[model samples]
Target: MTSDNKDRLGSKLHDVEAAREDQWARQRDADLLEKMRERMSKTACPHCKQFLVAKSEAGVPLHVCPAGHGAWIDAPALKAVLKEQK
Candidate 1:
């Protein structure tokens, strides 16, 4: 292949990778939202005095604060939420 063609292919590969990353991020965010919605009905966030959200992150509930106060998350127990915690 010509050098130009090789460059074009490389560029296209980069674009594809970037697009995939973006799509994955969107999917994760959406999943978090759905989890939050379910928790909102019965959960509460002690940090911002709002509701808590559930998630499948890893350590704890991937709760987030849409209002910007952060997330009120807990491990084996529930406690006062932190700041910029997400």
Candidate 2:
């Protein structure tokens, strides 16, 4: 192949690789979030032993104890909530 054609092929390959990596990362994040949701749904409040209720405030997702025991915010959600407060 000519030099220009070879360079174009290399660039296209790089773009394809980057797209694949992005897709993989998105899928991995989705899987992790799904697992977290499943675990959270099954979790009971430490103090009340009642199933925690899914909730959101300031667009931050969290789990609140049905018995008014307390709330649970994952690290990412806590960070988002705190950021929004400021």
Candidate 3:
């Protein structure tokens, strides 16, 4: 094949590869977003109106807003965490 034709073919191949990578990245991002949404709490934070993310600190389970609005911990759990701090 002529050098010019080979260069064009190589450019096309590069474009194809870039398109595939872009598609894979978009799919990956979508999957990650879905998983994150699934893990989020059904309840909304009263302070921020955002969904909460469940977490454990010092073995105490609590729901925290992703916006850093505030965390929801039951009275007993709060006592446990505070007691442990002392």
Best by lDDT: 2
- The 0-to-1 C-alpha lDDT of every candidate, in the order given, reads 0.65, 0.87, 0.82
The better-scoring model by TM-score among 2 and 3 is 2
Q: Write the per-residue lDDT of candidate 1 for residues 1-86, one digit (tens) a residue.
A: 99999999999999999999999999998997676567664665556666654554554555665565666454432532333354
- Candidate 2 TM-score over all chains jointly: 0.69
Superposed model 1: Cα runs more than 4 Å off? 42-86
Candidate 2, residue 28: lDDT: 100
Which candidate has the top score in TM-score? 2
List runs of model 2 lying over 4 Å from the truth. Answer: 45-58, 64-71
TM-score of each: 0.48, 0.69, 0.46
- Model 3 misplaced stretches (Cα beyond 4 Å): 41-86
Quote the RMSD, in angstroms, for model 3. 10.5
Each candidate: RMSD: 8.7, 2.7, 10.5
